[model samples]
Structures are given as structure tokens and as C-alpha cells.
Target chain A: MTKGTLYLIPVPLAEGAEHVSYTPFQLELIDHIKEYIVENEKTARKFLKAAGLKTPQQELRIHDYGKHVRDKVNYQELLAGALRGEDIGLMSEAGCPGVADPGAEVVFEAHKRGIKVVPLIGPSSILLALMASGFSGQNFSFIGYLPIDKGARSKKIKDLEQESQREKRTQLFIETPFRNNQLLSELLKSCKPQTRLCIACNLTAPDEYIRTQTIEKWRSETVDLHKKPCIFLLYAG
Target chain B: MTKGTLYLIPVPLAEGAEHVSYTPFQLELIDHIKEYIVENEKTARKFLKAAGLKTPQQELRIHDYGKHVRDKVNYQELLAGALRGEDIGLMSEAGCPGVADPGAEVVFEAHKRGIKVVPLIGPSSILLALMASGFSGQNFSFIGYLPIDKGARSKKIKDLEQESQREKRTQLFIETPFRNNQLLSELLKSCKPQTRLCIACNLTAPDEYIRTQTIEKWRSETVDLHKKPCIFLLYAG
Candidate 1:
């Protein structure tokens, strides 16, 4: 067995470095790591450049995970890299790694290999949205995205709505940037008038919007659906 | 219009300074506030004592929330406390202010009265559990606590399990401390053998355990049912 470690570094939900405050233990882990892996080499360089003196843009190399093929991940090669007594930081495009991103396999493999894995807290839209949604939190789930087809998506909505109403669960899901309008319209058209919806738009940003209202109210009113990316959630009594 | 600030203070899971790491910004928010509405009198004293000192025994003055009974909150009295230049820190017994707590009513009321509500980042089991579950985060649901009655609870589980399978959603829920064993047994008994289960126990603690296994494996395993405080997560693929 080789000694290795994996850092699941959570990036900010939105831009700006002020929000990336790692806990004392987490920062220490990052500072001691010998190898760094970022989603994009360019972004990794920028992060290092911002650090001024101690940051390693050159020595601590980054792996290029091109849009994550979701199939062709070189697990052994990555494991070989880890076996070289190097620690890797798996950075997601945004939010927590492995939640809606490409770090799941790496985490799973690392665990299988008995490599120590540490996840640093920074920012997460899923948790932030949940905090403000005013929904039941004892138990909740977050499915990253949904089918784009209106028919398939509508059926999914119906199922989620039934779960929310009949099971006393709060349903949470999101959509792509361009399809938000279509999804919002479908939500208004399908869900009952009394079902509660919480739309967290551009979370952790200056123009952040956390709007909660009934579907009836949303249908009667006009909201700028194009303003930002959103994590739309529904809660039914 | 009355102007006031609503602070979302993150308390520890258990009362201890080591268990909490209040950020500099959060501490600053606490220091500047003269009027704060805490959850209870003892917690108020605990906060005050912890705020200005290095430990939990220091002296600091904090206003108690008195109670959470809807009619007994005396919203007008709290408003008066705010109007008189009180920076109200809506503290909960544990975790963040909103989820699984009663600060939402105050936060909502503050929003209605045009108060500035600022939420801080701290320990939240919901976020920690979801992060480590490794379930599909794209679509998920959170149902708080389940009914204890065997018949009603079993029916609810069946409905939730069916919905999750139909929609491929992750159903999240919790149980009372003493009822965890009963719930786990019910989950294994009612849900299909192939249904995916993720149990997050003692999250964020050194004794934390998060396992994702099928219900079939769970039924035959020698799992200790004495673990009281835990979160049960179901994912039917």
C-alpha cells in the first residue's frame, strides 16, 4: 500500500476569493499538499497567481480533466500519481466536488485504495439553497439536473410533486442556463397552485435572489427568469 | 419603516468552544450587536460568556428569545428590542438558524418589516451528510422526521420509496434518537432489496460513518441497532 491523500476542495458558488475561507484544519491540509489537481489549468494558475509568494503555479502541477468524459477517467494513472507520495486536490467547476461533478470516481477509488480523503468546506449552492428554502431539512436529497424534454421533465415533476405532498419531502432539482425559463414555465403549468417553490438565483453573489412563493403567485406574477442560474426547489405540505 | 439587522448565527452541535469555530466576520457581527434574540436564557448566557472570552465561561450580555411558542414570541416586543438599536442575533440551540429550527419565522418577519438578514456559514449536518452520501445530487428530496406509528410510518416509507424509484430521486429523512433502530428495520423490511441506502451516522464527528449499500446487504448485516442519532437516506435507482 502506498501513502496518499485526496483533497475534495469546494470552490465558490460564484466568483470572488473573499468567500473561500477554509476551516483551520482544511487550510493546513491544502498548505501541506505536494500535488494539486484542478478542473482547468488556467483557473488553477489564476488561483496560484492570486496567492502571491507561497503559491505554486509551476511546481504543484495540475491535471487536465477535459470536460470529464464521464467514461474515460484514467483511474490507475491517477492512482499511480497518488502512489508517488503526492497529495491531489480535486477541484470541481463549482460547489462541492462529487455532488454534481467529476470527482466521485476519484473519491471512491481513493477510498478503495485506503488513501486518506479530506473535503474542505468553502461554498455550496445546494446547502445554501436548502438553508434558505424554508423546507424540511431532517432529510433532503439533491439531484443535480433533469431531462430537458418537456414531456419527460413533466413526468419527473409529477413524481417529485407526489413525493413532496404524499411523503412530506421537499423536492430539489436544477436546470441548465438556457433552459431555466422553459423549466420554470413547466413548473408553473404542472405543479398545483398551493405547492411552495423556492428559487435561489445566483447564490452568494451581489445580485443574489432567494424567492419563495406559491406556484399560483408565481404564475400570476412575472419574475426575471433570465437574470441568473438557479437551484429551484419545491416543498408541499 | 423600522431598520434592523437579522444575524444567522451558527451554534455548535454540542455546547463547547472547541466544537465551534466562529469566523472573524461572525465574531465581529456578534461583538457589535447590543440587542440579540437568542433561543433561550441559558444559551444566551453561554453565547455571552463565549463571545468575549477564550472559553465558554466568559461574561457577555445577550438577550434571551424566551420561547418558541408561536403566540408567546411577542413579536412586537422583539420588534421593540430591534427598534431600540438592537442587532438581533437569532441563535438556535444547535446548527444553523433556519433548517430544522424556528428562526425562519423571525427571519421571515424581519424580511416583512424590511430588516437586513445576514446568514453565516457554519456546521450543518444536512450539508455534511449530503456531501458525503455520494448519491445523485441533481435531484433530491428532504422529508424531516417520520411518524413513529408502525402502520403510518411503513405506509409513508412505501409511498416515498415508490416515488423515488419512479423518478430516480434520493429520499432523505431522519428519526428520533430512540426510534432509529425501529426505522432502520422498517426501511430494510419495506423497501425493495435492490434499493440503495446511505446511512450517515455522527456526521462531522470523529466517529462519523457514511455507508452506501443496498437494502439486501443491510438486511443480513450485523449492524448494531443501538445507534440512536443518525440520518437514513434512500436512493432507488
Candidate 2:
């Protein structure tokens, strides 16, 4: 018997942004997938509904892979349905699955089982930010998050800045939303004066803001990024 | 007076893949924007027509930034429409604008002129390949292309494998379509047996192929990748 394919679906970066985040084809694909492995069941069901899932919410089979259950879940058991010829959809809490999320483990498991993996197109904040950053997209790095330790974070920032200058590559990283302001101040203090910095906040939202400016110019201005989803890009070259 | 926003648009990576690559909101936005700065005039016009552009092709203003004219083009003049309060769209030959394309220069010019930059949702091969590669997405780098010289390319591949093992970061890069098979052979020869490699070709197309395996296993298989657009990802961890 042939194994069913695994579809990696993407959720919107922000709430209520589905209209611009999903394509008609994605909605049609999801309509045929009744089983899913999602980061969070509640949000995933809500998203599936938004994406026009025709199946009743309760009738659809969902295996939660959220933070609380991630460690205890069996990777192979997740693909058992696919092995039984049932197409399974994989989704994260936000953005694309398998990137900056625990979904990669499931995808890896699918590969081990010889199942086909198909990735659909959707809104990815990291990709969107890089597109609007005005940086060297030819060579870029997305380092998920910096160290939480103050000293280590500072050192990482400086290292990224130096590498950016030496290689002429764009360095991208994100910070926790509540600590956004703190990270912003730290970035300004840690990077060189002439390094170009681009702060993209609330991507794909009504209040989206994206701008690139030199560290020197940013230091002279004041902006609050507290509790805002943002992607910070640095390019010293 | 408020300057017009610079909309960075993305074209489907493969021909006739727009149905799955673009959202309805993107089509609506393009319908209203009659001016565009594109890498190739012929392809861009064809893409716009496929994307549901209502404006007559002859009535639209297009600034060609194709390879031959890229060096001679004055970027400031490309944004003349936006400067005069008309929204301008920026597109590349394929995939997202301002990424691995000459569109970055135009975006940078827009930032310098204080024009707002908005990125629309679409398919990005690099992002999609990472999503399905079952590799580390937490920390990844797109180094664009490796050195062309035989010795230099070999050394670079070894260095990337080492870096991937040390940092647990996925290394993504591409080769000229015709050189894909050559690069594949070089990678199998330069890396350790356990290092994982994923080759994603003709992404988002009917013939799309994505798979991951260790170097040892890949050496035992035979495949042809000549003249096919592809992305190579490495993960030694």
C-alpha cells in the first residue's frame, strides 16, 4: 500500500491576517486533509476554520504537539496515520511549520518512514522581513534567537555585527515580544555606529512598520517596541 | 504630502504556479498598482497577466532592471512614481523580490527616500525547502553560492559541513542549474558519511522533489539534476 503524503501548512504571523496569508489552493488542499498534527489544538482548529475546513471541528483528528506535550509525544505514532494511507497536515502555532518550531521533528519522522513531504506557500515573517529590509538577501542568516543571558547576548550581537561586516552578509534574529524594547536598546549599544539596522514590527498586520537606518541615526531617535512581534536585521557592510 | 508605499511582490518560483503561490489579497493589490520595477519586462508582463492585472499591459509603466541593464539603471528614477504619490510594485524574475535578486538595490533606495516598504505574502523556495528538509531551522544561513574553482569549492563545502556540525545550523546554498549534479558529487565526496543533505528541485511545481538522506546513502543512489532549479541544504548534527 502507498503511504499518504505529509502536508506542511503555514499559519498567519498575526491574528486575523488569514486573508492575505493563505492562497485559494492551500484552502482547497486543507479541505481534503482530515487529520493534523498541530502545535496547539485550539488555535489550529480556529485556523483551519478560517482557512475554510469543511469538516466539523470535533470530527477532525488532531494530535497536539504544543510545548507541554512535545517531549512526551511519540514521533512514529504521529506518522502512523500517514502510513495507513491518511494524508496528515502539520501546522505550527504561527508562521511556517518546521522553521523556528518543533514541527521539524515530525517532518524528519515522515522522511524516515518514506512518506512524501509537500510544503505549501504562506506568510513567513522572517522571509517577509528579509524581503523588505533592504539588506543583502543574496547572503543572509536567520539565527532564531539570541542567548537570554545578558552577557552572552551582548557577545553574540557583537559577533554577528563583526561577521556581517567581514562577509557582507545580512544577519537576522528575533527577541521575545515582552522584551522587545530591552533587546532594541541592547542592539543599539552593541552594534557599531555605521552598521545598518532594520526593525520590522507587526508584519502582515494593519499597523505594520518596516524601516532600515544606520545605528547612528537610530540612536538619536526613540521608539517603543514593547510587546510587538518584530524581526531585527543587521548589515554592517 | 505622504509618499506612496513601495510594495515588494513575489512571483511564483515555477511557471504557471500562481494558483498556489499567490493569495487573493495580492491579486487585488496588483490590480490597483499600474507601475512596476521588474527584473525582466517580458516575464514580468506575463506574470502580471496571469496574476489578474486589470490594467491594459500597454497602459502600465514598467522599468526593466534585467541583468543586461541592471548596471546602467538609475534606481532613483525607478521609484519616480512612488515619489510622486503613486504606489509602485517591485518584482523579480522569480520568487520574492529583494531576495537573491537585484531588487534589493531598489528597496534600499526606497528606504533612503523615506518611502514605506510593504512586503506581500508569497512562495519563497529557500523558505519552503527549509520547511520540508527536516533540518535545523532555529539557526540557518543562506550563503547564496559556493566558490566556482574546484579546490575552493571543495574547501568551502568541507567548511560548511564542519560549521553545520559545530553550530547545529542548517546551511542552505544553490548552484547554477547545470552544475547541480557536479555539486552533488562534490558534496558526497567532501562530507562525512553521517552528514545529512536535502535537494529540493522545481519547488511548487508538479514535478517538485524534496528528500533528505545521509551522504553514505546518497552515494548509493543515482539521480540526474542537470539544468533544474534547486536548493541544497546540509545538516551534520
Per-residue alpha-carbon lDDT of candidate 2 for residues A54-109, written as tens digits (9 for 90 to 100): 88887899998989888888878888899999999999988999888779888888
TM-score of each: 0.81, 0.98
Model 1 score (lDDT): 0.68
lDDT of 1 by residue, B91-200 (tens): 77777776776566666566445455656666666655656555555556667887777899999999888988887766778877677787889999899998877777
- DockQ measured for candidate 2: 0.87
lDDT of 2 at A80: 89
What would the per-residue lDDT of candidate 1 be over residues A78-179, giving only the tens digit for each residue? 766676667777776777776766566566566556565655555667766766666655445576677767799899898888877875666678888777
CA lDDT of every candidate: 0.68, 0.92
Backbone clashes in model 1: 13
